[model samples]
Target: MIPHAALQTAADRFGTPLYVYDASELDAALGRVRSAFGGAQVYYAMKANPNLTLLRRMHAAGVGFECVSGGEIARAEEVGASGDRVLVNGPAKLPGEYAAGARLGATFVVDREEEVGLLPPGSRALVRVNPALAVSTHDHLATGAAGSKFGVTPAQAPGVLRALRDAGHTALGLHVHIGSAIRDAADFSAAFARLAELHPAVSDLDVLDVGGGWGVGADLPGIAREARAAASVFGAELWVEPGRYLVAQAGTLLTRVVGQKRTGRPFLLTDAGMTELLRPMLYGAEHPVTALWEGEPAGTWDVAGPACESGDLLARDVLLPAPVPGGLLAIGEAGAYGASMSSTYLTRPRPAEALWEGGEWRPIRRRETPQDVWAMEQGLE
Candidate 1:
C-alpha cells in the first residue's frame, strides 16, 4: 500500500534509495492484529525498525515494546513505554541488557538457563520453548526447528519453569516464536496445538505467547481459532509479538534505476542494493517490484543493485515495462526487516528513513553523509 504520490514527494524531497513508511498502513495492520487475535496483548518487536517516531506512535497506540538489547530498552524508555508492558527477549542476552530491563521492571522471555540467571530473584518471566516444529516458510526464518537457537526444548522447559519458581521467580507464561514470514494459519495452529499439549507441564502459566510470523495476507481466522484453543486449554491470555506482519506491507523502498542494459539478458541496475535491503540475497525473500513511472512494452529483466557481491539482487526473471536510466522502482513489503537489517557495507552510507504521517512526509532518520561512514577512520589519523 505504498502511495505513489506520497512516495514521489518523498523521493523528490529526500532523494533516491529512501525508506518510506505509511503511518496509516502501520496503524491499520495493528488494528487487524488486535481484531484478528481477539485483542491479544501485542508487543511491537522494536528490533524490526526501532525508529523513535514509530516507536512513539506504537506506544501511543497502546502497544507494548519487545526489546532484544539494552539499546532497544533505552529506545522503549525514550518513547515512554511502560515497564510492565515491556519484554526483554533474545538467545544471548548480555548482563547489561538484563540489568536495564530489570531496572524498568520489564519481563524477561528467558531462552536459556544462563538467561534465567540474568533476571532478578523474584521477577516475572516467561520461558521460550523450542518445539522443534518447522513452519511452512523459509528455513532461515524458522526458529522452532531442532537445531534452532531460539528456545529451550518443550520437555526441558517445565523443569526450568519449576526451577525458576523454586528460585522465587514468578513464571508468567511460555513463548514460542516458530519463525517469521509464516503464510498459513495452520502453521501457527500446529505450534500452539503442541504448546497446548505441553501446558500441563508449565505450571502456573498466565499467558500463552504464540509468537508472530504472519506473512502478507496470512490466514487470520485460522490463527485466531488455534490461539483461542490454546488459551482455552491453559485458561490464560494470548500474547503475540508481530514484527513483519505489522510493518512489511506498510513500507516501500524507493530506489532509482541507475542504468538498464542487456548483457545476454536485460539487467536493470538500481541505486539501492544489499546495503539498503538484504532480504533477497540473505533469505531469498521476494517482494513486489513495481515501476513508479510510466510503462511501455513488457520485457523480462533481472533487477540488481550496486553492491560488490554478485548476489545483490532484488528480483529475477521479472516482467516489467521499459526502464530508463532514471526510472524509480518501488520495492513493496519492506517495512519490517528492510532498514533494520541494512549495513554500511562497501563503505556505502545507509539510506534515510521517512514516515508518512498526518498526510505529510516527515523525515525520521536523515540520510548519512560519506563522512558518517568513514568518521571512525578519520579519528585514528
Candidate 2:
C-alpha cells in the first residue's frame, strides 16, 4: 500500500487531477509474475500505462513488452527495450510499422492475412487466433468472440500460416486473447485448453501466447497453475502479456473537490473529468474513491467530473463523508488505463504525472499548458 502521505505530498507539489504511480508496488507485481511463471516469457502490454518511468524500470528488470501500435513500440524502444524484448501486435499496423519491428528484431503477432506482407521473408511470427470463446466479461471487451475485429478465426489459421510460409515467413506460434478484465480462472484455462488442442495440427507451433485480461483481485494462482499445466502438455514456450495486472493497483488519481451540491442525494464535483480518466464513462469501470481524511460514511454521494457531458460521472451512489469543497479525494486502482486513455476532450489540458520512487515524488509527464494544447492549431485561423 502507498503511504497516503506520499499522495498528499505529490498533490501539494504538483496540484490536483494528478497521477501518482508507486514504483515499488509495480516492481513487486512484476516480481510475483516472474516467480509464478518461471522460464515463461512475460510481456508487459504497454497500452495499460506507458509512462516512461514505469517502462524504464520494467526494461531494467528484463521484462519484455507487447505493443499494440507503432507509438507503443516506440515508447518501449525509447526505454531501451529492444528485439526479443518487444513484440508488435496490431491488426491495422501502418505501412512502415512492421519494418520498424523488423529493424528492432521484434516478433509480430500477425492478426490478419495481409499483415504478413509487412514482415520480411523467413522472420518468425505468431498468428493470433479468434476461437470465438464467449468469455464472462463485458461484451465490448470480449475480443476473441466471433464477429470481433481482433484476430483470424481458427479455421483461417492454416490458410494464414500457409500464406505466411508462402511469403517466406515462419509461423512459430499461435496467440489468443479472449477478452479484458476477465476474473474467472476458467476463462483463461479454457482458452489455453483450446490452444493446446489446436497445437498438434499446427506444424510449427513452438510457442503459445495466451493474452492477459486479468482483473483486479483476480484468481492469479489458479490461472498460473492452469497455464503451467497447459504449457507442459504441449511443451511449447509460454507467453502471457499482462498490462493492467502489473500497474492498475499501483496508481491513484488525486482530485480536489471543487463544488458540492445537495438534491436529496449529495453531489460532489471535482476538477478531474472524463477527459482525464474515461474508464468510468467509457467502460463503467469502478474504482474505490476515498477522501483524504478518515471518517464515517455520511451518505451515498454522486461523484462527477467537470466534463460537459452528463455521462462524466466517476461513480454514483457511493458512500463518502459529507460533501465538502476544496477537499481532496484519491481514486484507487487507477494505475492502468487512467492516464494512458486520457484525452484533451473539451480542450482540457492533460494532467501531470508523477512517480513515487525511493519515497520521493518525481515528475514523469508534465502537465500540458493551454499553449501546449493549442500549439498544433496555431496559425490555422
Candidate 3:
C-alpha cells in the first residue's frame, strides 16, 4: 500500500473531495504488466482517467494510448502519443471522428461493419469480432456477450472483412474486448482460441488486439495471474487496452464527514457523494471504506453521500472508527472509474484531482464551482 501520509498531505494541500494518484505506484503496475506479457504493447485506456499528468506519465513509460472518440484522440496527441502508437476502438464512430483518426495516422481504427464505409482511403484497419464470450461482471459492463450491440458478431465479421478486402482497405488485424473486470484468465484463453481459428483466414495479421478489462483489487493477484496466463497463449504481437487494473489502486477519494446519525442503522454522511463518484450509486459497485484518523473501532455504519436519493450510498454495514463531523475518510481503489464517471447531479461541483510524488502534492484539476456549473446555461442571466 502507498503511505497514507502521502494521502493526508495531499488532502491538506488540495482540500477534501480530492483524487490523489501515486506516480510510483503507476510505474510499478505498468512494469508488472510489461514483464508478464514480454514485448506486448500495452495501451492506456484513456477513458478511465484522462488527467494530462497521468497521460504524460503513461506515455513516458513507453505505454501507448487507446481512444474511443475524437476527443480522446486529441488528448493522446496533447500528451505526445503519436497516431502510430494509438489504436481507436469503439462500436460507434461519427464520420468526423473517423476522418480525424485517419488524418492522424492512428495505428489501426477498429471497425464493427457499421462504420466500414467511413474508413479513409488507403488506411489500415482491424475488424472487432464479437465472439459472444461470457464475462462475469455487472450487466451494464458486459460488452462482448451474445446479443450485445458492441462489436461485430462472429457471423458478421467475415463478411465485413471480405468487403474491406474488396474495397482495397488494408485489414491488418482483429480486436476483441470481452468485458470489464473479468476475473478468469481461462475465459481469455478460450476467447483467444476461438479467434485463433479465424487467424488462418485473415490476411497479414500483424496484430491481435485484446480489448483490456483486467480485473483489479476486487480479486487481486488472482486476476493478475489470469491476465498473464491468457496473454501467454496469444504468441502473436499482442496489444492490450487496460484501464482499471493499472490505476485503480493508485487512487483515493478523501471526503469530509458532514454528520453522524442512527436510524435503523448507523449512517455517516459525507460532503462528497454521487456527484463526485457515481460508481457506487450508479452501479452498486463495491469500494473499501475507512476513516483517515486513528480512533476506537466502531460497529457497522451506512456510508452515504449528500445526494437526496436514498441510493446514494458508498457502502452499507461498513465497520470503521466512529467519525466526528469534519473528520476525514478515504475511499480506496478509486483511481480508475471514480473521477472519470463523475456527474453534475444535484448541481454539485465536481471534485479536484491531484498527483502525489516525492512527498509533494500538485493539483492536476481544479474543483468545479457553482458558477462553473451554470456557466454553460444560456438563460442563466
Candidate 4:
C-alpha cells in the first residue's frame, strides 16, 4: 500500500477533487498480467480511464489500446498508440468514427453486423458473438447474455462470418466481452468454451479478443488465476482488454469533510460527491472509504456529496474514523472508473489529475475553471 503521507502532500498541493495515481502500482499490475499470461497481448480498454497521462504510460510500457469510439481512438493516437496496435469495438458506430478507425488502420474492428459494411474495404474485422450466457453482475454491466445490445447472438456468428468472408473483409478474430466486475472464474471459462465452439467455422483466424471486464476487489489473485486459466484454453494469439483490473486499486478520491448532519441517518457532507465520483449514486456501487487522519474510533456515517438529489449518497451507514470539518477522506478502488466518469453536474468544475512517481506528485491534468465550462457556448451578440 502507498503511504498516506505522500497522499496527504499530493492533496495539499494539488487541492481536493484531485485524482492521484501511483505509477509503481500501475507497473506492478501490468507486470502481474504479463507474468501470468506469458506472451499474450494485453490491451488497456481506454474507456475505463482515458487520462492521457495514464494512456501514454501504458503505451510506454508496451501495452496496446482498445477503443470504443472515434474520440477514444484519436486520444489513443495522440498518446502514441498506432492504429495497428489499437482494437476498435462497439455495437453502434457512427459513419465518421468508422471511417476514422479504418483510416487509422486499426488492427481489429469488432463488428455486430449492423454496421459491418460501414467499415472500409480491406479492414480487418472480428465478429462480436453474444454467448447469451447470464453472468452475475450489475444489470447495467451485464452485456454478454441474450438480448444484450453488445454482440450478435451465437446462432448469428456463422452467417455473419460467411457474409464477411464473401464480402472480402478480413475476418481475423473473434471478440466477446461478457460483462464488467465479474467475480467468478467459471463465468469466464464458460464464456470461452462458448466461443471455442465457433472457432472451427471461422477460417484464417489469428486472434481471439476476450473483451476485458475482469473484476477486481479484495480478491484479485483468485480473479487473475481464473482469467489466466481461461485464456490458456483458447490456445491462439490471445488478447485480454482489462480496464478495471489494471488500475482500480491503484487510485483513491480524497474528499474534504464540508459538514455533518443528521436526518434519518447521520450524513457526512464532503466537498467531493457524485459530481466527482458517480458510481455509488449511479449504480449503487460501494467504495471502501476511510478517514485520512488517525483519530477517534469508527462510527457509521452516510457519506454524501453536495448534489441536490437524495440519491447522491456515496456510501450509506459506512464505518469511518470520526471526521471533522476540513478532514480528508479517501475513497478506495477509484483508479478505474472514478474520475473518468466525473461530470460538471451542479455546475461544479472537474477535478485535476496527478501522477505519483519517484516519491513526488506531478500535475498531469489541470483542474477545470468556470470559464472552461462555458467556453463551448456561443456568447451573446
Candidate 5:
C-alpha cells in the first residue's frame, strides 16, 4: 500500500486524476511469489500493467513475460525478452501476431485444436486446457468456466499436444488458467485435478503452467503444493503467470473533489471518471477511497466522476470526511488494470502516471493534452 502522505504529495506534484505506483510494493509482491513457489518459473502477465518502465524492472529481476497480443509481445521485446522468455497466449491470434511471435521464437500457447496448424514450422508450444469448472469470480473474469471462449477442453488437450508434435513443433505440455481474481483455492485444486487426470493420455510433458488468478491474500503456499502435485504426474516443470496479484495494491488513483451533489443519495463529484479508471463501472470493482482533507466523519457518500453517465461512479457508500472543493481522494488497489484499461472516451484525456522510488516521485507517463488526443485525426499534409 502506498502511504497516504505520498499519495497526496504525488497528487500535488503530478496533479489530480493521477496514478501513483510504489516500486517497493512491486518488488515485495514479486518476492512473495518467489518465496511461495520455490524453483518454479514466474511470468508476469503483462496485460495487467504493461508500463515499459515496469516491464524493464521485471526484466531486470529475471522475470519472464506472458503476453496476449503482438503489441504486448513487442513491449516484452522492448525490454529484451524473446524466445523462451516470452510466452504468447491468446485464443484468436492474428496472422501478424503469429509473425511477431515467430520472429522472437516465442513459445505459443495453443488455445484451440485448430491452432495446431497455425504455428510457425518447428515452433515450441503448449496446449491450453480448459478444465471447465465453475469458479467463484465475476462472469467476465471466469475464462476457464464452462461455455467460456478460452481454451480447448481437458479431453481435447491431449490430441492438441499430439497434433503440435506431429506438425513438427515442440510440444511443451499443458496450460490451465481457470480465471482472474479467483478467491477459492479449491477452484485451482479442481482444475489441477482435471489436468492430472490427463497424464495417462498426455505423457512426457515438459511443463504444466497453472496460469495465475490468485486473489489478494490467497493461500499461495497451499495452492503451490497442489500445483506441484499435479506437475509431478508427468514430472513436468511448474510455471505460473501472476498479473494483478503482483500490482493491485501497489497503485493508487488520485482524483480531486470538484463539487458535491444531492440527488437521492449524497455524491462527491470528481474530476476523473470512467475514462480515467473503468474497473468500478466495468466489473463492479470496489476500490477503497481515502479522503486527504482532515475533517470529522461526515457520513456515507458516493463518489461521482465528471461524466454525465449515472454509472460513472468511482465508489459508493464510502464513509468519508466532509467534501472540500478541490480536496484529494485516493482510490486504492489500482496498480493492475487502472491505466492499462483507461480510455479517451468523451474526449477526456488520459491521466498521468508516476512512480515512487528511492524516496522520490518520478513521472513515468505524462498527462495527455487535448491536442494530443486529436493529433491522430488531423491531416498530416
Candidate 6:
C-alpha cells in the first residue's frame, strides 16, 4: 500500500486524477510469487498494467510476459522479452498477433482447435482447457466456466494437443485459467483435480500452466500445493500467469473532491469518473477510498465522478469526513486494471502515472491534453 502522505504529495505535484504506484510494493509482490511457487516459471500477465517502465522492471527481475494481443506482444518485445519468455494468449487471435509472436519466437497458448492451424509452422503451443467449473467471480470475469468463449472443453483439450503435434507444431502442454479475482481456493483445487484425472491420457506434457486468478488475499501456498500435485501427475513443469495479484495493491488513484451534491443520498463529486477508472461502472468493482485531509465525520456519501451518467460512481455509501472542496481522495487497489482500462471517453484526458522508488517520485506517463485526445481527427494528409 502507498503511504497516505506520499499519495497526497503525488496528488499535489502531479495534479488531481493521478495514478501513483509503489515500486517497493511491486517488488514485494514478485518476491511473494517466487517464494510461493519455487522453480515454477512465472509470467506477468501484461493486460493488468502494461506500463513500459513496469515491464522493464519485471524483465530485469527475470520474469516473463503473458501477452494477449499484438500490441501487448510489442510491449513485451520493447522490454526485451521474446521467444520462450513471451506467452501469447487469446481466444480469437488476429493474424498480426500470430505474426508478432512468430517473429519473436514466443510460445502461444492455443485457445481453440482451429488456432493450431493459424500459428506459424513448428510453433510451440499449449492447449487451453475449460474446466467448466463454476467459479466465484463476476460472470464477466469467468473465462473457464461453462459456456465461456475462452478455451476448449476438457474433452477437447487432449485432442487439441494431438492436433497441434499432427500439424507439425510443438505441443508443449495444457493450460487452464478459470477466472480473474477468484476468492475461493477450492475452485483451483477442483480444477486441478479435474486435470489430474486426465492422467496417462495427457501424459508426456512439458508444461502444466495453472492460470492465475488468485484473489489478493488468496492462499497461494495451498493453491501451489494443488498445482504441483497436478503437474506431477504428468511429470510436467509448473507455470503460473499472474496479472492483478502482482499490482492491484501497489497502485493508488488520486482524485480531488470537486464539490458536494444531493440526489437522495449525499454525494461527493470528483474530477475523475468512468473514463479514469471503469471497473466500478463496468464490473461493479468496489475500490476502497481514503480521504486525505482531516475533517469531522460528516455522513455516508456516494463518491461520484464527473461523468453525466448516474452509474459513474466510484464508490457508494462511503463513510467519509466533511467535504473539503479541492481536498485529495485516494482510491486504493487500482494498480491492476485502473490505468490500463482508462479511455478518452467524454473527451476526458486520461490521468498521468508516477512511480515511487528510491524515496523519490518518478513520472512514468504524462497527462494527456485535449489536443492529444483528438489529434487523430485533426486532419489526414
What C-alpha lDDT, on a 0 to 100 scale, does residue 22 get in candidate 2? 86
Q: Name the weakest run of 10 consecutive residues (lDDT summed) in model 3.
A: 217-226
lDDT of each: 0.86, 0.85, 0.78, 0.80, 0.91, 0.92
What's the CA RMSD for each of the models? 1.4, 1.5, 2.5, 2.0, 1.0, 1.0
- Estimate candidate 1's RMSD in Å: 1.4
Q: At residue 369, give the lDDT of candidate 4.
A: 91
| Candidate 2 clashes between residue pairs 3 or more apart in a chain or in different chains | 122-168
lDDT per residue as tens, model 4, 1-381: 667888888889989977888889889888877776667688998888999989888989889888988889899779877765788878777777777787778865555665556677877887887888889788888889786887887778878767777788877767888988888767777787787677466544667777767777424455445545544454557777889878988888888899998888899998889888888987788889878877776689999899898988878887777777888888888898899999988779999888889887889889999888878875765
What ordering of candidates by TM-score runs from best to worst? Answer: 6, 5, 1, 2, 4, 3
Sliding window of 10 residues with minimal summed lDDT for model 4: 217-226
TM-score of each: 0.96, 0.96, 0.92, 0.94, 0.98, 0.98
User: Which consecutive 10 residues in model 5 have the weakest lDDT in total?
Assistant: 1-10
Ranking by lDDT: 6, 5, 1, 2, 4, 3
Candidate with top lDDT is: 6
Our model 4 lands, by Cα RMSD against the true structure, at 2.0
Query: By TM-score, is 3 or 5 better?
Result: 5
The alpha-carbon deviation from the true structure for residue 238 of candidate 6, after best TM-score superposition, in angstroms, is 0.5
Answer with 1 or 2, whichever has the higher lDDT: 1
Better of 3 and 6 by TM-score: 6
Candidate that beats the other on lDDT, 5 or 6, i.e. the better one: 6
Task: Report residue 202 deviation for candidate 1 (angstroms).
Answer: 2.8
lDDT by residue for model 3 (46-77), tens:
99888888999888888889888889989988
TM-score computed on alpha carbons, candidate 6: 0.98
- After superposition, candidate 5 runs with Cα above 4 Å error: none
Query: In model 1, which range of ten residues has the least summed lDDT?
Result: 113-122
Q: Candidate 6: lDDT over CA atoms?
A: 0.92
- The TM-score of candidate 3 is 0.92
